[model samples]
Target: MNTSASHDPNCIFCKIIAGQIPSKKVCEDEQVYAFHDINPWAPVHFMLVPKAHISSMAQLGQEHAALMGHIMTLAPRLALEQGCNPYPDGGFRVVVNTGAEGGQEVQHLHVHVMGGPRPWAKG
Candidate 1:
């Protein structure tokens, strides 16, 4: 959760998780949904969103931390699904953008798993 869905009635990420806005589904559970980013920055850029709309990491508590742990544990697996590898020439990056200053555009809590061969290469 990086932005404030609490105030946005038309938040796209929220609608996607709620099944109101469709997206390229990747991984999902009762707690979260992971999908490819519509506008990708890396070879692999997928977002893992919690089904519960919690706005920002600052609002997170012990319960949310536990859920966050679960999200991290799945990040690597999700990255692999997007073709990320962890070898010398293959690996991935996991990121959680917290606010506008952190480059977050969505308000709902989500994790970004991105990488692949030469994933970190600068073009």
Candidate 2:
């Protein structure tokens, strides 16, 4: 996911990182990008994605483990920033949609940060 979606030339995420596409950015770094999802699944449904453009989990090998850990760590931190665990509450959900059958919309790998439980939380 962090390999440069630009390779596709039509990658929406790459276009976004390149400023060719528009997105409501939540965070950004040299190696990653975070933004609000177009069709959010939850109140805090944001995306933390690597800039490398790695397509799916199956495509990731040894080199990706570090980045994966970083993504996971970043998720909870960002969730807290977004007001997760507010009041006496606690925790949020981070989802990685792996493949087409897994409900991944974009080809780029992205971590879905979800908070403020909704109806979908039940099933």
**Model 2, CA-based lDDT:** 0.77
Model 2 agreement with the true structure over 81-109: per-residue lDDT tens digits: 87677535667787877788887878887
Report every candidate's CA lDDT. 0.76, 0.77
Off by over 4 Å in 1: 1-9, 119-123
Q: Report the number of clashing residue pairs per model.
A: 5, 10
Worst 10 residues of 2 by lDDT: 1-10
Off by over 4 Å in 2: 1-6, 86-88, 120-123
Q: What tens-digit string does per-residue lDDT give for candidate 1 at 64-104?
A: 77788889888887777678876566778777888899877
